[model samples]
Structures are given as structure tokens and as C-alpha cells.
Target: MLINDGLVRARGVRYATASRFAKPEPLAWDGARPSERGPACPQPPSALAALVGNSVEGLSFDERCQVLSVTAPADASGLPVMVWFHGGAYVTGSGESTKYEASLLASEGVVVVSVSYRLGVFGYLRDNLGLLDQLTALRWVRDNITAFGGDPANVTAFGQSAGGDSVYALMLVDTENLFHRAILQSAPLGTRSPERAEMTAALRSSISVDESTSVEDALAAQTAAVTEVGPKFPPSGGMPFAPVLDDVDLTAAASRVELLVGHTADDGSPYVPSREHWEAVTELIFAGGARELARDWAAACGQVATYTFRWAPADAPLGSCHCMELPFLFDPDGWRGAGMLAGQEPDPVLAGTMRSLWAGFARNGMDALPSRSLEFGG
Candidate 1:
């Protein structure tokens, strides 16, 4: 019932085929087919949605999202692998988010795997199940990426926002060669990661809804409870959903790998008290935290590179706010969903620079890399 042409054939100088290599669901089954995009982890509407013209509302979200997509150049073998994680404050986003497209990056001679993991109450309400989900996905890539013409040995991970925090988690966890390098963009590392009991207490104390709360009602109430507080959320009482430092698996060796970390200039504006507060937060949360991680890695293993993105469109009211660099790094043409953060059109020169830097890191392992890490607003 099968034909050779259907199994393996090409058009336009490239041939591609995909399969659901693993079924991570509770109900495991084999012979998974590659047909459609996986569901995104569910989440409430983002507040930034209003400011960004509700463009973020229409994309996609669902529960069955613990999957990954790999794209590679044709005629490729032993190519490095770059797995990507998108950011939505541990609540929103998926590997399918328009911002994490892997085509452009894969075109540069590496296998690009965009991963989706659990989020929100499904992830961190009790323990770090979402993080565990990410670990599982990474393990899958480590074991099977070679089938896609990728080099299992030269795996690299890159993430942004909450995704960036996940990358940092890889450094603290016992990765054991799961990946050889990482890139963290706009990671909120300074945010406090409390111990397990403390974090659980924060969640318990934040919302009062009992079992009677419908799934949708509970999700709404929980989102309101956490966001009602001022910009710097998960306030004084507890942290509803953040990584617990104490739960780190100490038995596994601490990860040592070349790292690249960065944040945009106005990263804190929409989340801080005033313009002045935003500036202070940028110093404390982004710059200071990057320096600490860099110094620690400098002492531990391979070299570290850090950058600050100061480029903002002339008319941008919020300046180079959180995740402003994503469009430049991913797809400038398809980044309209980014709204005001990326402006009408992004800077091509800056895009080329970032593309080169990231691809080089994915290839060369930080032994030799560019240094103009900071890009002042043009």
C-alpha cells in the first residue's frame, strides 16, 4: 500500500518528511503522524493585548502542546541542533508562536527545533511540572534529533522571557550534555525564585476559589488575583507561579556550557512604577542579573557573552520594551503581531547582525564570537 515516491521524494531541491516520534500524553500510542501543528498550552488573554491592539488574541492556544518541530537544510548531516522556547511569563505562548519560526534559522545550516511545553496552573501550580515537561522534550531531542540530520552532540538551546528563565534553569539543573550551549533573551533572572514550600504557600494564599470553581472560572480568578497587584506581581505574600530553587536536582551535575544572555533597554517600563522606576529595574533586574550569571559561568566552564538592546523606534512610546528584540531575531516581515514593540518595520542591519551572532554561537560554541553586544537605538 506504500509507494517509494510517497516515502521519499523531492521537489524544489528539498525533501522533507515528519512523524510524531513520541506520544507524551497519558495515553501512549505509537505510529504518530505528522499532519498539523500541536495545540498551544492554554492561557488567559494577556493584558498587553489591549495595548498591542489585541493582535495577540487570535493566534492559537490549547492543552496538548508538549511537542517540538524540527527544520533543517537539505543535504545536511551532522549539523548542530538549536532548540527554541518561547516566553509568556510561564502562562502563555507555544513553539508555534509566530515569533519562534525556525525556517530562517534552519536555513543557516542547523537543525532548528521549536518546542512547546505545559504552562500556567498546568505547569507550576504545585511542583515544577512544566519545567519537567521541558526537560522531557529536551531529552527527546537529545535522543532523536540525529534522525533529522542533526548532530546529537552539539545541541544548543535558546529561549526568551519566561523561556529565557527556563534556559537558565538548564544551567542550574543536571543537564548532563543535554545541550552544549544556551542563549537567553530578556530573561527575568532577578525575579525571586523561592523554595518549594514557600512558592506553594504563595499560590495557596493568592486565590480563594475552591473545587467548585469551574475550570474557566478558576483560571479567570487565578489570573485576576495574580495581576491585580501592581506591576511587580506575585507580591509580598507569595509567588503563585515561578521556579523553586530548592527543588533543583542536586544529584545531577550542574550544567556547564557557553552562554549568551541579553535584555532590551526599556525592559521594565510597562511593569515598573515610573520611567525612573523602569530605569532602576533595568539596572537591577536585567543588567545586574546578567553580570552575575556571566561571572558564575566564566568561573565554571566555557566563555559567556552578554548584551543590552537599546534600539527603539523613534515613535515607540515604551522604547525598547520587553521582547523587542524578537522580531529582529526571528522574522522581521512576519512580526506584525509584535505591534508597537517592533514598530512598522524593523532595522535590517541589526537583524543581520543578530542572525549572524546567534548562528555563529550555534556552530562555533562561543570559542570565537562577535563583541558589539550592545546596539544603541538607531
Candidate 2:
């Protein structure tokens, strides 16, 4: 049967089955018939090899939580594995977003897994409760990836924006060596203090409570207030809740992972323009400390693998905005109207270049520079 947006479904799960794409086969049970459902179930259409959607259950801290896992088919010569975290300020976003398609990356002969964890008020509000959900998700990958044809040893952790911030935090907490390599895109490393304070103040302000309020009482009150606001509150400054450096989860430590960091030319523009709200956006999000944070981040990331792209199209109203190069990097088919790729087919030159660079980093700790002429050493 056809699923939403032309995806094919057999049983209850949906599978991407375009003729240009190979169909994934269902996972086999350990000792039962092929028809028997296993703990880790996969999908159908044998051409694609494997596509399994499983969950890592019984998390230690949060009883109701589970980390969703998406495993792709293996490569012809056994490619590496990349565990990707989606960027939505750590408050919003999931692994299932189309913005993070791993098909192109997987085609490079590497298994890719996109992770989903708790978000917003749920994930980042740990007091002394010791909730290491993100780390737990990583541990789950380390333990279970082999079942999905992935090499845990060669895993690379990569993320953008808030996800990128998480990557750096992972480094600080001695989890750097867990992944072979790391890629941080458009994230501010040194700006966490102010940003965390802002998030805390916003959360406190949302509840109209003081800082002395207990975690449990604050959470209860906030939940009630939010419910009064009707299910989900309207998107505002109070929504993108992130982690705070409570001397536990985040600490002062040098990063040990091989880092590849870069920023777009103009990552401060709007995707959809509104003349009325333009002034406000310019004054708030794009002004003052936000601008300085990017520069400060570059300065702080000193001597790491750094490359800056000033991508701009003559017809485009703005230069490279936040997430502008993602489409090119991922080679998404529908992103033709984005940045430099506007009204054109996916450029093989760019796609191949990025794939090779990223693949080399994943395979080894070193970032394979795309061009020798481009200076990557900060």
C-alpha cells in the first residue's frame, strides 16, 4: 500500500521505495521463522538490503523515555557508521525530520543512524537527578548498532546549530573519545554562559516564579501553566529550552575529539521575509551578542579544522543564511531553490567533495580537506 508522500508500506511501517532508490528488507529473527516478529524488526523490499526502526527501551533515568533508532543498509565494502543528532535548539526537532536524510551519506558506503531524544522542558531540566539521556542514547548505539550492520568503533558524531553545541559539550565531558571524529557546524562554543543564563531566565519567567523554586515544584507549576496555555504554547523566546552548565553535565575540560568546524557566509538572515517583523528580528536575533558569539566561537575554536564558506547567489536576496549549505551538503532533491543550488540539479562537484571530506573524517580522526588551496587550519 502507498503511504504518505508516496512512501510504500507493508504491514504498518512506511518505506521509501522510489525506483531510483533500492528497497530495504525486513530484519530476521534470531531463532524463529522469517515471518516471526523479532525484538528488533526491520522493513521489506529486499533490494534495499536493510531498514530497521527500533527503540532502545528502559532508560535508567526516565522510565517513560526511549531512544528511537533508524538503521540503513550496509555498503558494498562495509562502510563506517555515523550517528547524527538533529538541530532544533535542543528543544524542538526529531530524527525523523526530512531535513536530515541520511540516504546520500549512506550511499557513500556508511551506515547512518539519526537519534531522537527528549526535548524542551523534558530533556534539559535535570537538577541533581542525574539525567544523562543523550549519553545514554550514545551508549544504546554502542551496544545495539551491530545488530543493524553498523560498526560501533568507526562511529562519527556530527551535528549542526544546537546539535552542534551538544557535540562540543560531549567533548568537554570526556565523551570525545567515544566517537572517532566530530563535526560542528555554525555553533558558538564560548557563548554557552550567556545563552544558558538566558534560557534559565526565560524558563523562570514562563512560570512567573523565582530562581529559588524547587525543581519539582517549578516543573509542576510550569506544566499547569502550560496546560492553561493550551497543550503547546505558541513559539516564542521561552520555547527553545537548552542545557545549563550545572557543574555536572557540563564542566571545564579540553576537547579531545578531532574537530571539523565551519560557518556559512550569512547565517543570520530569514528564510521567509516579513517586512513588518523584519526590524524586530534584526534588532533581537541578528543583532548584538548573537553576531559577536559567532566571531567569539571562531576565536575560541583556535587551531582546529576550520573552513568558512561565503556562499551567495546573485539572484538570492541574502547570502548564506543559517542552514543554507545543508541542502548542498545533503544533496536533497527538493532543495533546488536553496542558496547556490537555486533552480539547478544537485551539483556533483559539491556533493562528491563533501562526501569524501566527511567520509575521510569518519574513517579516521583527521579531516580530509576538500581542497589544498583552502586553508582549514585556524
What lDDT does the true structure give each of the candidates? 0.65, 0.47
For candidate 1, lDDT tens digit of each residue in 12-51? Answer: 1101111121224332213242535555666776545533
Using TM-score as the measure, the top candidate is: 1
* For every candidate, C-alpha RMSD to the true structure in Å: 6.0, 11.6
> Candidate 1 at 365: error in angstroms?
1.5
TM-score for all models, in order of appearance: 0.82, 0.62
Give stretches of model 2 more than 4 Å off.
1-65, 71-78, 127-131, 174-176, 188-191, 198-202, 208-240, 246-255, 271-303, 334-346, 370-378
Cα misplacement distance, residue 210 of candidate 2 (Å): 17
Clashing pairs in 2: 23-48, 267-322
Q: How would you encode candidate 2's per-residue C-alpha lDDT over 1-378 as one tens digit per residue?
A: 212222211111111111111122222223211211112111111110111111111112221222344435532234567777656555444554445555666666666666555544445544301124455556655665665556777777787766676766665554435665677776644344444555555564565433455445645665654445422322223223455654443222323445666665554454235534543433343333234533444455522465555554445555455565566556375354443444544446666767667777777655366542232111
